[model samples]
Target: MFGLTFEKLLLIGVIAAFLIGPDKLPHYAQQLGKLVRNMRDYANGAKDRVRDEMGPEFDDVDWQKLDPRQYDPRRIIRDALTDEPEAAPAAPSPNPNSAYLQHRAKQQALATGELPPFDNEAT
Candidate 1:
């Protein structure tokens, strides 16, 4: 396959047959076939083992999402630079009279670079 056509393959085969000699060509071909078969079997066995370990959820996995070919470094960097930061989650409702609410409000103001209001009598 490797961009090689039938004629190219035939040429390679002729050269190989000549180099390897006709008597040994069949033996080498048989070895190559066995190697290919073994590789395929190994790959299939690995898949089967993974399926057994992960159960049905293995089949539900998004294979294309996991493919490395889809990853583009430039696109990823562009998105990182261009995308806005996610909005913060809503704060929990606090008791109106709780000291925790007062402290939280002060923290929020400080985080925003503003000075918290100081009540002389409350302090």
Candidate 2:
């Protein structure tokens, strides 16, 4: 399960048989089987206990969304960076000397080849 393919397992088994010899092989193999069974039982029991405690909410959970393997830092960052900001409110400005009006006037003057207004007191 931990990246050990059939050939690798076979090689490992052959090496174990040679090192342990035929005399005590059966005893060791039986012990190994018991250990594997115990580990499996422990995992199953833990899962069952959690399910029992969680009740119906366990089934309702979106397991895939919670999975860490599905997360990509680069994709998350890219999406965040590319997302557009919400448009500002369309309410009319009450102030006559607003920066938006000043900017618009400057843009209009520039388009008509006229000098833009300069306020020395602005700085």
Q: What is the C-alpha RMSD of each candidate to the true structure, in Å?
A: 14.7, 14.3
Off by over 4 Å in 1: 78-123
The model with the greatest lDDT is 2
Candidate 2 Cα outliers beyond 4 Å, as residue runs? 75-123
Give the TM-score of each candidate. Answer: 0.59, 0.59
What is the alpha-carbon lDDT of model 1 when measured against the actual structure?
0.74
Predicted candidate 2 versus true structure: per-residue lDDT over 1-123, tens digit per residue:
899999999999999999999999999999999999999999999999999999989899998899999875544543454444333337744773454354455453365676778999998
Report the error of model 1 at residue 2, Å.
Answer: 2.3
